[model samples]
Target chain A: MAKQKEEKLHKIRKVTPGSVINYTLITLIALICLYPFLNVVAYSFSGYNAVLSNKVTFFPIDFTVSAYKEILGKASIWLSMRTTIIVTLVGTALSLTLTTVAAYVLSRPNLPGKRIMSTFMLFTMYVTGGMIPTFLVVKGVGLYDSLASLFLPVAVSVYNFIVMRTFIMGLPFDLEEAAKIDGASEMQILIKIIIPLSLPIIATIGLFYAVNYWNDYFNALIYIITPEKFTLQLRLRNLLFAGELNSAGANAEGIGTQVMTQSLKMATVVVSTVPILLVYPWLQKYFVKGVMAGSVKG
Target chain B: MKQTDDKNKAALRRTTWKQIRKCKWLYIMMIPVLAYFVVFRYAPIGGIVIAFKNYNVFKGIWASPWCGFATFQKIFANKNFWNAVRNTLTLNLLNLAVSFPITIIISLMLNEVLHLRFKKVTQSILYLPHFISWVVVAGIATNLFTQQGGTINNILNAMGHDSVPFLSDNGWWIFTYIICNVWKEVGWGTIIYLAALTGVDETLYEAAYLDGATKFQRLIYITLPSIKPVIVTMLILSISSMMSIGLDAPLLLGNSKVQDVSNVISTYTYQLGIQQAQYSESTAIGLFQSAINIIILLAADRIAKAMGEHGII
Candidate 1:
């Protein structure tokens, strides 16, 4: 008991004045970041009348789940959610394959015309043809209003490709040379050796692509005209915009609509954000490390 | 040695031919990326010709008759376009002047914190707002600042002051836009600086401490110099993107009263192209914006290289 008390006192003593100040500043900043999100949650949960009266701030004064119930009860929200999921999954898969394959090829020192190909790819980063021509091209290609429009147009990010290439370049060449000496084909070596070692970068880039695709509503807005093909973001945008038109004092039906709309908007934000946020903690260490590594080398 | 040289030449030619034969698979792999650029990026260059032509949907791109810069004439003739240009440049300049320094300062402070747990939590919290779309953020802002039942209004009413029309006021439009943008993006902007700060040598800080330097002095003399390359790189990048003052925030935040102050090149182009289908005029304006962006980027790159900083050459 005496030893335990002493150890606890030692731990307390280790907390210097600088550390105390640091912790306080960090806590304050964290609170500032967290407060607005909490306010949103509070407002979403608080009764409509309570929220209108500005009674809700950090916490709900009169709690209710009617907003959520109304939002979740709708079939359209579910459908949009389903579409967003499909787009995210499919888009990530396509992007990862294209980026990895291209990066692998470019990373090979023996690859012919590597420098020219790389330069050609990098040129696109700065000199895009602008929006009108792109829209016309999409029209020309018959991809307008199609789901492929979202995935295909942005199939590979040049930045991701560069990062992945840099990473693959940093890998020891001895392994590849060894595989070649053993008469292993290029495909076999890539499948067996290179892939296992490259998992961290692959995962990091995959998550980045996934998050980008999930957050993207721009493509859907520009390309998709049909209401049925709307992603969650576009759907949420429509709902939020719809709220603006009906912002006056709620009618009998309007109250339900407003509550439901507000709740669903918050819920949609949470839904779109949560999966990426959840994955972040798992992948964050690699992400930070990989990004720093990639940036510094580049 | 002569025989080996001849053999090597033969091998080189043989390998070149083999590569050509295998080019089909490589080309197939490149199709998606190439198609994307061709469709989205390269195709847009052709649309710039619409600026010269009196664009007609029926006549299509090729058949549209030349109007000899009538669209450019109209664009420059508009007083509203000049207002937009002025607004865009001023707002961007202000954003750079304020937010850039603040981002660096915040990053340095965050980096200086010794407690890992505290740093992680702060970073995570700070980054949260970045992920929430601007539309949602605008909604939140409106709710907070609304005259009737908003939190700000409630506080003002309690303090015996009349509520201000934050959203509707033309004077407040730029300020509102800047604040909302800063709120949403300050954390994200700090990322590169933080990454740069991590590279700062700990020994320098220790040396400053031994010389009896205070934290502020250490930051000024040691920390700032360590991250100078990163600062320059980011500054140049930001300068390059000056014309792309995003459309979403202003579109959501600006009401009819504030529209004159809030309208920018991008929003103007969207209006002209997508709304009015005045493709020629819009493409002209877009091309103009692109030209300016390219010039700025080249100039910035040149300046960086002149200063012995690495650039995206």
Candidate 2:
């Protein structure tokens, strides 16, 4: 295996025609994926005229920070940003707690009624309560139009629960038995030993929850009614599509006028997306592991 | 004999109770999770019955009168509902047709890329799109595909050609939609295949090379066959989900003009249920869609098993 791996490494320099084609195709696909983000940055930072005249492509023309300033200056944008941050933070915390506890309880192979409880959770994955009825329930429970409606209804994802459970299951089972023999309770084992050891899986699942909460516009669109409570994704949607300008400092010249700066529009995307991009390189491997574990067994 | 049987039953009950008592804390931990599933997951299922009722918002579900199959009938009679159903299938199939093979080809290409570092970087870039919100993707698409100021269109204009209406026209909208979908997920789709790729026997490749098999020939014979099961499983999985398209993509990417092609089942339900407040009818449509989905899923799983593979489900 080591010999083969080393040979594979050496083959990089011995580039055949097929390898050349492979490299070119891979690079092209990468560029296609990446160029849009570059364009987003270019449009977000370019001068107003440059954006208007379509001068920006992959690089900023007459680069300026006014679009970012304009967007950041607005009360609506900041409010939405605050709402998104709260959702991501609170949602991730709740999801991690719920998923961790459930995973621990389910990972106990000797636990009575494990099959029933696990099948109950797993069934939710195959068939869901479809959209409208779920909406009615949320509304019926008095979560309608409230900020709690954003995250509380989706407190735990079954897939993430399973992934976390799978991770916990893969740990040496004897450790828990040893703890039990030492007079440690199940809760004590989970709190004192399991959590500390399961930090990687915790972070992976936590990031999953965070990204879901941050990019969640559909939930906000359906559940949230108040303008001030709109999440960042929903707020960006309105700014991009509704042609509704701000009522504040961002548009001091013409308040409530439909004067949209394309640059500012693109800036919202950048602002919304930059966090994901920043952490993506780090997130890629963990995400890959989570998917592999969750999927292969499934 | 009767007394002994009763005593045995009593002993079983006591052991069961003891086991429960031992893991009592685990049971305590399960309360919130159990309540969440009961309230959020199963309640909505029970709520799906309102599709058969004359659902009144003020009257509530319990008070709503039964209308037999009237709500389902109303949805079935609507032309737009049929249109939405057709559009959903078209877009999903089109999306699968374009994306599935491209994903496999790219995975194969990625596998052949000799430079490990370059391959990793490429994969990283590809996976980036799967993380971004559809709102941002829609925003980026608009900025890049619009006729007037869209960068791609602008480039065309600069070359003295009329700009293409990528988003507005129906035919082009589907094409653009497929392109966007492929761009977003094609990279992430490779993860499973690449994992499968690593398990392929290296000796087969070495043997093929010793026999003077060309690179393309080796790829076709050795590389492709190795990952066929993953490919089939993934294909069946996608096919099973044909009835369901995410609400975000179509609802965001679509405009007034392209609604004919873009108005999918999920979006249609949203329009009727949430926007128009025709709650009962919307629920009926959802129920109908899910019924079809289950049938398709079962059929696909059977097909998988019939082909001498483990069922997808």
Candidate 3:
């Protein structure tokens, strides 16, 4: 048995010249992928002179927190941050609730009118009213120019609903059937049996929703009119493209212009992205599972 | 027998109605979702009718006068609309050409690695960029590709070469756009392919090894064929959606200097409808794009089925 095991291990670990090349190529590609992010972090922490001199690369030459301090000290940044937090939290909750309920009900294969209901949801995936008409609807519904417009207009993602429903439908039906025999109601069955068994998919769908809400700026850009209601991504776009770093700082005329350099811009980028980056490693395994499940589509 | 068939049909209809009535709680749960679809999805579709009318702000959507394809006529004549269509197709084709094969090749390479640890780390790093917003990506890109104190430019200057206008010159701007896009999405694209690759039976490779097949030969004979369905499916899906580009990437990566090349359908709709208040014209363009999209989708599905692959439709 030991000799057979050794032979199998040898077969698996055969040193191929091609594999050596593959490893080297993959490592280089991975470094290439990671360097841009590292460069952003390096520039954000590097001193102004180091940044101006183009000395910062993948590491900080002369580190300082002044850029972060200058950006984070402002009232507008906090206000926008607050607004973004509110939207992401409320949007994710609303989306998950709507999606969960819809998915659970739709997952039952024996449900009447299931075909029509699913077709109603799936048709939206292919064709939509386009942006302008959707904009008109938002306005017509009186959701225009409000924080609600940012998320309420897109409350239940058809893709997310399909994924969650697929997950639910794939579960063992015997448990639910037994519970039904024991006089458990559908709601009770869902809350007691389905939810506990569906933690992985629920977590995956929740993360997808949170990431969508967190990263979205277009909804905010179109529907949100007020300066105070700008989400983090919208505010970042304004600063990055329009160079609104002046409005983000308390004392603008002197220091804002002086500090409104590339370093400061990159610093703001890093700060806005930190929340997702912090949670990513923990959420990544679920993300891969979610993608794998969703990829098996009709 | 015919009379029994009629009786069965009647009984089935009654049972279906009874089942629906019995599942009152389920339907009650579905009300909010149905309402959401009605207000947002179905209503927007109905709102597409504004394309055939002169939409008035005060008169609202219903009171707007019917114009009977005049809005579409105006859109069809506009040079900007043609330019947008041209740019949209150009960028999408370029993206498909560059990123599609690269994703497959990367997935193949990752599959070949014996070192599981190395492969896992590489994949984790590669997938990171897909999660980052386009705003951050554009910001990082501006820092790296700008002609002034850009890092790449600094390297070029140090090598005694002139700095390139990555984001300014039209040709270079397209190159930059594709690079950023591929960098961001190429890794994430491999997930599906890798998943497909895993479904390939290991016995095929083992038998090929007994036949003294080289690694490359095994890949060609045993691996590629296994995932061909997935490849074909993805290709059809990508081709069908060729008319649409997301607003975020082009809008964020683009500046006024390259508006001639950057203006696509979504951005054009935004600029015209929201910024200039040409709601009718913009919606007309949108409806036109949607018509082409549906046609392409149906054609692609037909092609897929003809090729003996499952149609996405």
Q: Using Cα atoms with residue i matched to residue i, what is each candidate's TM-score against the true structure?
A: 0.89, 0.94, 0.95
Question: Which lDDT tens digits does candidate 1 get at residues A26-47?
Answer: 6786686676677677677778
lDDT of 2 by residue, A83-142 (tens): 999988988898899999999999886689999999998888777769999999999899
Give me the candidate number with maximum lDDT: 3
lDDT rank, highest first?
Answer: 3, 2, 1
lDDT string for model 2 (B163-227, tens) is 99898789999998998899888998998998899889998987786687977898899988888
**Candidate lDDT (C-alpha), each:** 0.75, 0.86, 0.87
Least well predicted 10-residue stretch by lDDT in candidate 3 chain B = B251-260
Fnat of the models, one by one? 0.38, 0.66, 0.74
Give the CA lDDT, 0 to 100, for residue A194 in model 1. Answer: 76
Q: Report how far residue B101 has shifted in candidate 3, in Å.
A: 0.6
lDDT of 1 at B190: 79
- Superposition-based RMSD of candidate 1 using all C-alpha atoms, in angstroms: 5.0
- How good is the docking of model 3, as DockQ? 0.53
Cα lDDT of model 1 by residue, B1-313, tens digit: 9999999999999998788565545556666666666666667765678789988889888898999877899999999888878778878888888889888878877886766787787887777677676656776776666556666667788899998766667776677678777778888677778888877887677667657786679888998999998898889989998887787776667655666787878777766777667777778887788789999999999999998998866
**Docking quality tier of model 1:** acceptable
